[model samples]
Target chain A: MTVQLQRSATVAGPVRRVRRSKHRPIWEEQPTIAGYVGKTVALTLIVLAVLYPLYTIVLTSISTQATINAAGGLVTVPGEITFAAYRQILSGGIVTRATLVSIGITAVGTLLSTTVSVLCAYGLSRPNSFAHRPILFLLLATMFFGAGMIPTYLLVSHLGLIDSYWALILPTAVSAFNVLIVRNFFMGIDQAITDAARIDGAGEWRVLGQIVLPMSKAVTAVVALFYGVGYWNAFFNAMLYINDNSKWPLQLVLRSYVLQGVTLPGSGVGQVDVASGAVTGLPVKMAVVVMAIVPVLIVYPFVQRHFTKGVIFGAIKG
Target chain B: MSKQVADAAPARPAGTAQRGTADGGPGGRRRRPVTGTAHRRTSASVPVRKVSMWAQIKRDRSLLLMTVPVIVLLAVFAYVPMAGNIIAWQDYSPYVGIVDSPFVAWDNFERVFTNPLFLNAVKNTLLITAFQLVFFFPIPIALALLLNSVITPAIRTTIQSIVYLPHFFSWVIVVTVFQQIFGGASQLHRILAGHGVHFDLMTDPDTFLILITSQAVWKDAGWGIIIFLAALSTVDPALYEAAVVDGASRRRRTWHVTLPALRPVIILLLILRLGDALTVGFEQLILQRGAVGPGAAEVIDTYVYYQGVIAGDWSFAAAAGLVKGVVSMLLVLGANKLAHVFGEAGVYQRA
Candidate 1:
C-alpha cells in the first residue's frame, strides 16, 4: 500500500508537468489573435507613456542649442549631442551644490534610518521579549495617526530644526510600516538558533550582529532602498522646513527652475554662468531633471528583484 | 500615502530553515506560535523557567536599548506634534507662543469651514479624488491581468521593471514630463499647431482634471499593480484545475478562480485610497497650483500650508488641518469596518 501511494505521487507530478505552456498553465485558453494584438498595443502605449517623455527630455538635455531650436521644443531626435548642460551645471553652482546635498542626505539618511529600523525590528522580533507588545503598539500607533502639517511644522520650528538639513531626515525617519514589516520578518525567524547561540554564551547583541542580521540582508537592503528613495525624492519636507535656498535639495531645485516657469540661474552665454541654479536653456533644465531621475533608475533594479522574493510580500500578507 | 509601495519579497533563509524544522518536529497543539521563551524548543530542551518582567527586562537590556531611539523619535517627532494640534483652538502667535495664545474655541473652525477658498479647495480635492477613483483605480488591476497572461517570465519581469519605474519619480519630474509633452507649447501642442488647430492641456483649468488624473495613472498605477501581481502569483493552480474539471469555461474560471483571489488585495488598496481621500496629490498640486489657479487646484494640504505657513493664519490653518485629519481618520476606520462586513481583512486587523 505504501509503495502504491509513492508510485501514484510520482505519477501525479509528471501529469501536472504535462499541461503547462512555459509560463502559463494549459487549463487557461490560448489568447486570441485580436487579444494578443490588443495586449501588445496597450503595453507598448504604457511603456511609451513613461519612456517617451523621459527620452525626449534626456535627448533635449544633451542636444546642442542649434538642435533644440531646430526641434522648436523638446528634442525627440538627437543632433550633435554635447554634455554642455552637464558641464555647466556640474561645474559649481546651486545645481551642483544641490546634487551634493541630495547625495549626502540619501547616504546619511539611509544609513541612519536603516540601522535604527533594523535594530528596532530585531529588538521586537523575539516573541515574549520585554515590553514587546506595548513597544510594538507605540510604533504602530503612529502609522494610523500623524500630527497634522501645522503641528509638525511647529514642532520642527520649536526644535530649531527649521532650515536645518536634519529636519528633513529626523522628522520622517522612522517609518513604522517598515518597522512592522521587518519585525514580522524577524519574528518569522526560528527561535532555536538564537537559543543555541545564547546557550553557547552569545548575548542578544552578539547573536543579532552575528546571526540574525546575516540572514536578514534581503529585508534590510529593501528597507534601506525605501529610505534612500524617500530621502532622495523628498520635496515636501524641504519645502516646509528649508527656507534657505542654498540648502535646497535636487527636487526643490527641479521644482523652482523647471516646473514653476524657469526664472533661470545665470541666463545666457555658450558657457552659462550657473550661479544659484538659474538657467535660460532648456538643456540645462532637462539636465537637472535627468539628475533627479538617474539615482532611482540605478538603484531600483537591484531592489526590484526582491519584490518576488517574498520577504516583503509576507508583511503585506498581514 | 506613505511610500509603502509593494514590498513583497519571499521568505528569507531563516524562515525556510524554520519551516523545515517545523515539518520534522512533533505535531501537536504546542506547535502553535505562543509567545515567551517558556514554550520555545530550546527552552523545552533546557528546562523552562518562569521569569519575572524585571528579570526579563534585565536579560533583554541590549534588545530593549536597541528600540529606544525609535521610541524616542516617535515620542518627540510624532506624538509631540499630535499634542501641538491644540494651537488650532487658540489664535496662535509666534511672539506669544502656545502657552500665551488666546483661546477662541470653535471660532477658528467656523472661519475655516465658512471660507469660500477653503470650501473650493475641499470641493476640488473631492472632485479630483472621485474622478481618479473611478478612472485610475482599475488600470493597475487591468495591467496586472494583462501582464499575467504573458507566457514568458523574462518578458513579464522586464515589463514590470519598466512600468513601476515611475513610482520613484518625484512630482517635479512627473509634472515636468507631462508639461513638456502636453503643455500649451509642448510636443502635442506643436504637432496640433502645424495643422492650425489649437488645444491647451496642462495649464488649462478646464482640462486640469484630466491632466492630473493622467499624471496619477502614469506615476502611481504601475506601482499600485505590484500588490495585485503579488496576489495573482499566490493563487493556487489547483483551484483552477478543479474549476476546469467542474466544466467551467476559461472565462468563468478567470472570473471565478483568478479574480476572487485578488479580492482581498483590491479591497485593502481601496480602503487605503479612501483613507487618503482628503490628500489628493499635495506636492503635485502645489507644484502646478500656480498654473491652473487655486480655483481648480487647492487641496486641504495646500490650504493648511497657505493658511498657516504662508499667510500666517496659524489658528485657521491649524483648524483646517485638524478637520482634515479627523475626517481622514474616520474615513479609514469607517472603510475598514465596511471591508470587515465584506469578509476582507482591509488594511489592518483588530485581532
Candidate 2:
C-alpha cells in the first residue's frame, strides 16, 4: 500500500505539470474580443492612473522655467530640460542640510533599532529562557494599547528628550511589531541546528551571531528596510519634538516646502526670488519631493523580492 | 486596518510549546537538553536536580543581558507613557506635572463627550472610514483577480511592482502629488479655467471625503493586493482541474472554488478593518485640514493632536484619546470573538 501511494504521488506531480503546460485551464478561457478589449483598457487605465502623476512630477522637476511658464503649471512634455532645480536644492542649502539630517537619522536609527530588535527577538524566541513569557506578554501588550499623544509627549518632555535627536531615534525605536517579526523568523530556524551548537559548547551569543543571524539575512534585511523607510519618511516626530528648523529631516522640509509652500531663508529659492522669476518654486518643490523619495526607490528593488516572503511569514502565521 | 490586524496577532511560540512537552514541566526550571556527545555523557552520569529560580536566571545570564536594554527601552518609552495616561483623570498641566495635577475625576471625559467640535470630528472620522470600507476595501481583491488572470508572469510582476511603488512614499509626497494634480493652481485647474470652467477637488469641502478616500486607495491598494495574491497562490490548481473535469463553467468554478478559498482571508481583513474604523488617517487629514478647514477634515487622532498638543487642553485630549484607545481595543476583541465564532484563528487563539 505504501509503495502504491508513493507511485501515485510521483505520478501526480508530472501529471499536474503536464496539464498546466499543455492546456489552458478552463476557468481561464480565451475571452471574447470585447471582453479582451475591456480588460486591456481597464488595466491600462489603472497603470496610467498610477504612473501619470509620477511622470508629470519628474517632468516638471526637470523642465526649464520657460517650459513651466508655458505649461502654466506642472509641465507634461519634457521640453528644454535643465538640472537647475536639482542643482539649486543640492547646493548646500536648507534642502541639502535637511537631506543630510535625514540620511544620518535613517542610517543611525535603522542600525540601532535593528540591533535592539534582533537581540530582543533572539532572547524572546527562546521561550525556555527566564521570564520569557512575561517579557513576551509585556512586549505584545504595547501592540494593542498606547498612551495618547498628550501623555507620550509629556513623557518625552519629562525625560528632557525635547529638541534632541535622541527623541526621534529613541521614543519610536524598537518597534514591537518589527521585534515580533524578527522573533518569528528566529523561531522558524531549525531547532536541531541550535541544539547541536549548544551541544558543541557554543554559548548563546556564538550560536546567535555565527548560526542564527547568518541564516536570517533575508528577514533581517527586510526588517531593516522597514525601519529605514520609516525613519526616512517620518516627519511628524520632527514637527512635534524638534523646535529648531535647522534640525529638520528631509520629510519635514518636504512637507513645509511642497505642502505648505514655505520657502526657508537660507534656501536658494526664497519666496521673493521665486516670485521675481529667478526660479519657479514648482521645480524646486518637486526636486525636494524627489529627493525625499529617491532613497526608498533605490533600496526598494533590492528588497522587493523579499517583501512577499517577509510579509507572509511575519503576518499570516503570527 | 491591515496594520492593526498584523499588530494584534502576536507570534505564537509553537516551537517552545513543543519543547515544553519534552522538558517534563513548565515550571521555572532550566533543563539542559542532551544536545552533544559531551553534554549527553555528562547528563547520563549526573542526575538532574532542582535549581532555584535565581540559579536558573544566573545560568541564562547572557540571554538575560541581551534582553535588558529592550526591557529598559520599552519600560521608558511604552510602559511609562501608558502609566502617564492617568492624566485623563487629572487636570494635567505641563507646569504642575502629572503628580501635582489636581484630580478632576471624569470631568475631562465629560467635556470631550459634550464638545461640539469633538462630536464633529467623530462624525467626520466615521464618515470617511465608512467610505473607505465601502469603496476602498474591494479594490485590492479585484486588482489581484485581474492580475491573476494574466498568463505571463513577467507582465504580472511588472504591474505588481509599479502598483506597490506608491506604498513606500511618505504621506507628504502623496498629498503634494495629489495637490499638484488637483489643487487650485494645478494644470487641470488651468485647463478648466481656459475653457471658462473652474474646479479644485483637492480643497473642495463638499467632496473632501472622496478626495481622501481616493488618496488612501491610490496609496495602499497595490500593497493590499500582496496579501491577496499570496492567498491566491496557495489555492490548489488541481481543484480547478477537478472542476473543469466536472464540466464547470468559468464563473461557476470561481464561485465553487476561488471564492471559498479567499473567504477566510477576506473575512479576516474585513474584521481587522472594522476594528480600525475610528482611526481614519491622522497625518493625511492633518496636512489637509488647513486647506479644507476642521469642519471637513478633523478626525479623532488629529483632534487629539490639535486639542492636546496645539491648544494645551492636555487633560481633555487625553480623555478623548483614552476613549478612542479603549473603544479600539474593545472593537478588536469583539471582532476576534466574532471570528472565533466563524472558526477562524482571527488574531490569537482563545486562552
Candidate 3:
C-alpha cells in the first residue's frame, strides 16, 4: 500500500505535488534564500509589466473629470469614480452606432464564415469524397501564395463590393487556416460513427448535420469565437473598403479617437468634459478603447480553454 | 473533458471499441463491411481510391454541393485577383480595365527596381524583420521556460490567460493603448511635465521601429508561448528522472533534456517566421505613420498600400506587389529547404 502511494505520487509529478507540500523533484536542489527572493521579484515585475497598463486604462476610463485633472491625466489611485464615460459612449451617438455595426458584422460574419468553413472542412475531411485531393491542394495553395493587395483591391472594386459591408465579410470570408484547423478536428472524429450513419442510409448532409456537427460543438464554438473576434477587431478592411465614416466599426472609431486624437462631435458632453479642458479627455478616449476591447475580454475566458487544442490541431498536424 | 477524450481517441486504435458506436455495439454488425474498407485508412494516411468520375461525383454529391460556395468564393476572391496580377505588366486604367490597357512589358518592374522610395521601403522592412527576429523570437521561449519551472498549475493558467488576452485584441486597440500611455499628449507625458521633464517618445521617428516591434511582442509573445509549452509537455518525464539518477543537476538536466526537446519547435517556428519576414505589420505601421512620418514606418506591405491603393498608381503598385508576392513564396520554399537540411519537418513534407 505504501509502495502504491509512492508510485502514484511520482505519476502525479511535481506540479501536483507542489499543491500539497514543498516537493522538489530529485533533479532539482532546493535553492538558496536569495534565489527564492530573486525569482519572486522577477515574477512580480513581469506581472506588473503586463497588468499595470491595463489597470491604468481601466482606471482612467472610470475616474471623474475633476479627479483626472487633479491626477494630471490618468488617476492611478482610486478617487471619485463614475461610469459616465461608459454612459456617454453607450448613449445614442456615433460610438453607439459603430458598436452596433461591429456587433452586426461580427454576428453575420461569424455565422457565414462558420457555416462555409464547416461545409468545406467536412468535405475536405472525407478522404474518399470526390476531387478531395485536388480541392485540398487548391485550399493549401492559398495558404502559401496570395494575390497581392492591388489586384485584390481591384477585384473588390470591379465586383462593386467597395463601400459595402460585404467587402469586409467577403474579402476575408473563409480563412483557409481556420478551415484546415476544423478539417483536422473533423478528421479526428470516430470514423465508426460516421460510417455507421452512412450504413444506416444517412446521406452526407445527414451524417454531417446529425452526427459530426453534434459531436463537434466545442471546436465549432471555438472556431466561431475566432471568427467573431476577427470581425470585431478588423479595422483595416473598414479603412480600405469602407469609404463612409458612418459605416466604420468600433475598432476604426477607436483608432480615429485614441490613436489619431480625433474627437468625435458628440463623444464628450458631461461634467468631466468641461473640467478636463480637452474635447476628448483621457477618460473618454480610454473608455472608447475599453468599449472596443470589452467584447473580446468577455469571450476570452471561454475560448482560452480551447486554444491549446485548437492550436495543436492546426500547428502540430500541419 | 469530452473533447479531450475524443481528441485522444483517434491516437489509440484499440480504444475505439470502448468509445462505442452510434447505434451501440450491434450497429457494428451492419457497419462491418463499410468500415472494413473505409476505416482501414485514417483521414491523412492514405489517398482516396480512384473511382469512375461519374461514380465519384454521385458518391460525394452532397459534399460537392456543400463545397461549391467555398470554391466559388475562393475562385472569385483569391484566384481572380491572381489573374488580375496581369495588370503589373500593363499601363492599367480602371476605365480601360485589364484587356484594353496598354501593355508595358518589363517597364513597371524596371521602375520598381529603380525607384528610391521602393528601395527605402525594402531596406526598412528588412531592418525591422531582423530586429524582431533577434529580440522578439526568444521571448516566448523564455516565458514558457519560466512558466514550466513554476510547479503550480493555477498560477500558470492565470498568468497565461492574462498574457494571451492581448493577442485577441486588434492592432487598432494595441496601437491606441500604447498611444494612451506613451503618446505625445499621453498620461506619461503629463506626469513627466509635472516633474519638469519633457518627453515625447511616441512621435520620435528614430525609435519607431523598436516601438512597433515592442508592440508586436507585447501583443503576441504570450500567444507564441502556447506552442512552446505544447512542445515542452511532450518531453518525457523519465528523461529528467534518469538524469537525476545519474546525478545531473537541474541546470544540466535542462540543458540536456529541455532545450533539445524544444529545438524542433523552435526551428519550425523560425523557418515560418523567415518566410513571413517581409510582412512587418501593415496596419500597425500605417496607423502610426502619421505620427512618426512615413520614412521610418513604411515596410513592404504598407509601401504597396500607399503606392497602390492610396495613391492610385495601379500598374506600378501592382508591379511592386507582384514582386513582393513572388519573393515571399520563394522565401517560404527556400526556408523549408533550409529546415530540411537541418533535419526538421518545416511546414510540410517535400513532394
Chain A TM-scores for all candidates read: 0.87, 0.88, 0.88
The Cα RMSD across the true interface for model 3 is: 4.1
Task: Put down candidate 3 lDDT per residue, A150-218, tens digits, no spaces.
Answer: 999999988898889999999888888888888999999989999898777676788989999998887
Q: Model 2, B78-106: lDDT tens per residue? A: 88988888999998888998889999999
Off by over 4 Å in 2: A1-28, A268-279, B1-52
Q: Which residue pairs in candidate 2 collide?
A: none
Which digits, one per residue and each the tens of the lDDT, describe model 1 over residues A1-318? Answer: 346445544545455634334444545555666877898899899889878888998898899978877777788887889999999888888888999999999998999999899999898888877788899888877866778999999889999998899998999889998887788777788999888987676767778899898988788878888889889998989999999989999999888877765465563212333552222377888898999999998898888887555344545755
Q: Across residues B85-162, which tens digit of lDDT does each residue of candidate 3 receive?
A: 999999999999899999999999999999999999999999999999999999999889887876657877888888
For model 2, the DockQ equals: 0.42
Q: What TM-score results for chain B in every one of the models?
A: 0.84, 0.84, 0.84
**Looking at model 2 chain A, which ten-residue stretch has the lowest summed lDDT?**
A17-26
Which one wins by TM-score: 1 or 2? 2
B5 Cα displacement, candidate 2 (Å): 36
Candidate 2's fnat?
A: 0.62
